[model samples]
Target chain A: MAVNESLRVLRTIHYDEHHYSLFVSAGTIGPKTKPGHFAMIQAGEGFRPYLRRAFSIADVTKVAGVPALEFVVKIVGVGTAALARFAEGTPLPVLGPLGVPFPIDDLLPSDRVALVAGGIGLAPLVLLARTLAARGIAADLFYGGRNENDVLKRADFERFLGPHRCRYATDDGSLGRRGRVTELFTNALAGGVRYRRVYACGPVAMFRALAELLAEAKLEGSFAMESEMACGFGVCLGCVVPMVDGRFATICKEGPCVSPAQIDWARL
Target chain B: MTVDLSTAFGRLRLKNPIGTASGTFGYGLEFAHYLDLAALGAISVKGLSFRPCHGNPPPRICETDAGMLNAIGLQNVGVDAFLAEKLPELARLGATVIANVWGDTEDDYVAVVERIGSDRRVAAIEVNVSCPNVVKGGMIFGNNPEALAALVKRIRAATGHPLVVKLSPNVTDIVACAHAAVDAGADALSLINTLVGLAIDLERREPKIGFTTGGLSGPAIRPVALRMVWEVRKAIPKIPIFGMGGIETVEHVVEFLIAGANAVQIGTANFRDPSLASRLVGELAAWCEDHGVARVSDLVDTLRTRPRPDHEFA
Candidate 1:
């Protein structure tokens, strides 16, 4: 069996106070990875620290056509903090473009695709927004950040969806919508807004709220959610969802992104 | 070029060095999309017991610094149900299948292991000694040297299959447990099952996960796991050891090998990517071939503890 080489970490740079990103050239993954997929990254040059951390594939922009992958990471704890300090030009041992990718191509022309993101959760949405732009899908994005700077990867969100459609909600109302982004989203839905497929990635609470809102609006949607993953692959039952259809399923193999209805939303 | 990941556990030789953890991999079928059941060194299915368990309720996990924690109380489909449901399918998967058995009492443990060992489908048995010994009035067997040793001996006499004792890191001295198990006729040891941990919720003034306390695993636990593996490896150099905690990649396998683990099991890594093993299997070969290394095993213990140019170790 031909095993792919562990991905080499191309560079590590800080994006904000509690956020950073790693660019890796892993042969095992896609040159243009789809949104909703993630990778299990092992940092620290040695195995003294044994576990691999899972991160969302925030942006899939190919670097010079070689198809390097980058993660939009939040330094929630120690592993990530160590990850941020990794020197540039070092190779990261990347494991995958695991889990289900967002259905970017599934968006309809007439469908108004609304991408909802919370805090650093905007990473994947930014890439999805760009794909939506390239597909010329009429869409908009609603983002909620604690403050203005916590908002992530806006360049693509603006460039792809047009600046007018992006709305923001900060606790202090530092930017656009003066409250929760979901509040703005709820307003949009209350105002007779229509979208073909609503794509969302954010806090579990945010994802739940959106699912509830989407249901209230009688709309179809998918969610890119996070689970505490040990393996970015499917074996570990650690990251799982109690499906509505019965039986527990792995998030990595079955999906990081699943139909909103398929999720045991009540469980979340 | 594929490296032989198999190593002997007394009479049984695992096909590869990679296996699954008791709690993390569940019953092992969830990965049908990404796993080739036969390719692994062995499959350590989820922890099973005499009765079905609901597991601790949700909020059962949360993200920590580099790792995560879970208190999934050996929730399983009861041993009889597992045999009836999962075994036939696993039989077809064709690799050595090791059942990780857990129970509240010595009789319970003996019974479960005996039942599993009788089946031709099961190649071996792993005793989950890390849990509290319900019969000994609740002190965990893994934390005490004599308790662990005696348990291993009891289980060994109960089953003919290769006996493996999974160790817990919650104790102050893991080496003692490792040593005791070997002395009691254990064929191998798989270890560093999550460190004891707790996560608090500021809002409700409550704790995260269904249980107030859970096992911590993931990237964060790697350092501790490596240290424990190194400690036990240094103390008992001859005994076969299967290392785990947060193993997620080919490099992790290499790390475990270097730290004295004969093989490594990908625990938390299985949660996010299903094809990680297949990919890592491929990656390890390429890494070996690229380095002009004749065998992947050559990388074991070869890494020097050179200080990284930057970053704080403590």
Candidate 2:
């Protein structure tokens, strides 16, 4: 079930010039918020910009004794730009605890999982990482970005999962391994690294490549897909993704997190 | 003074004058978790056809200035699924259900309406002749007076349910289309469906929407929608009108009524706030009471203007 709340911004943590996180009072929806669940956050007042922006729940924690929902956002368009400019205490209307989350229940303490995040894709993965830590599972965080500047929340992951368990790959070789993050993933798989399951959140191209890699590697994986939507719930049907069965799955309803087998990468 | 918010479109009566627009309200079940389903005046469920529609490809919607463009292609569960799966729950919820029916042909439209005949649950049949996103049967039937008349007549013959023909704003002459539906037995009319518009991505040199062109809706089109509702109302004063287009507030609802709508539907704004239509029902009542307007119906066609200049409307 989803609840609509007018959560005021408690603090805005800037990861960089473009990347930031808004920790807002989560009302009743925070306590139940899961890893891959997302919310439609309204950044503007009245009719300006007209639609709420959908963001993944990075983490649900407390700030100064108030329960809060953390949203990691990158300035991409108008809605995000407005969110970037929002002052502290500015009330942001949010609707969520929506969408299917990454299935962490299937993994045991002995099962090692790989968490891959690209750019602001780290938003959902952070909560997932924290949950994995709590469960005593050994998970590796494959954080990738265009450069060191684009990489976000590295210290947060390092503090929980340890620096040795975290891997970094940058497109420009500014941080760690050079070339695309998918390339690093491909190299890792080729080098005979094994995992119980892989969870990923990134651009569509990354998922398309990962789907093929996972298919070839015969591994189970979940990809958190993002789409442009009006309503974060199932009604709008605006954020539908083509499935292998020739039917479209509403991302807002069926998943923001989906099994690699469920998507039609060719169509996407 | 108590404010009377109840309104009617001939045989069809709504507890209030604020209903959810077709395509925006999906079977009235989606928003059940967000708000009480029965709280709205009516739920005009997504446009249904003889068969389930897949709609357009991804990237079907794009945000614009105070509005958005969508080419959803009217993705729906078909009429049988709605009747079997969706409608019963809506009826059970005590919400007024107006079936918004569309098809690829005139026969397709008749099949859906006839299947829904006197369900006892459905309050009215809103014929979606104005969906600009579809290639056939939608605006094709709405753009021409004779075609719309013929289609409405066929629909009229098929079912005893009150017919509300949703008109397209893309037409050259809306009054002719309004008259065609009314003369051919349409009980009421839903004015100003989304206007067809295109948005381009300069980087890709391609259209922002997957279908090249999509219907534009939201506050940006309110002025155009208001003008159309007023024009149709002035031309066809006697027929009932369910006006809609970019309506998000009580003030906009009042504007529609004064411009001659018996009721108003909240469209794209429902995407922004799923509970909006239900909220507007209460807000409208409070607004009416505060303004000393006892009856919501009293606001209909109440616009007063100085004598029109000879060339103004022409």
Q: Pick the candidate with the highest lDDT.
A: 2
> What are the chain A TM-scores for all the models, listed individually?
0.91, 0.97
Candidate 1 lDDT, B184-255, residue by residue in tens: 999888887787788887889898765677777887788888888888888887777778877767777778
Q: Which candidate gets the maximum DockQ versus the true structure? A: 2
Candidate 2 segments whose C-alpha is farther than 4 A from its true place: B310-314
Could you list the iRMS of every candidate? Answer: 5.1, 0.9
Tell how far residue A180 is off in model 1, in angstroms. Answer: 1.8
User: Candidate 2 chain B, which ten residues in sequence have the lowest lDDT sum?
Assistant: B305-314
Model 1: docking quality category: incorrect
DockQ score of each predicted structure, in the order shown? 0.16, 0.84
The TM-score between candidate 1 and the true structure equals 0.70
I-RMSD for candidate 2: 0.9
Best by TM-score: 2
lDDT of 1 by residue, A1-268 (tens): 1122467666665766887777776475755467777777776654434457778877765665656677888887666877887765666666666678888765567667788899988877766777778777887789998888778777768888988998889988788767788998988887887788888888888888888888878888888877766665554445677778655666767788888888887765
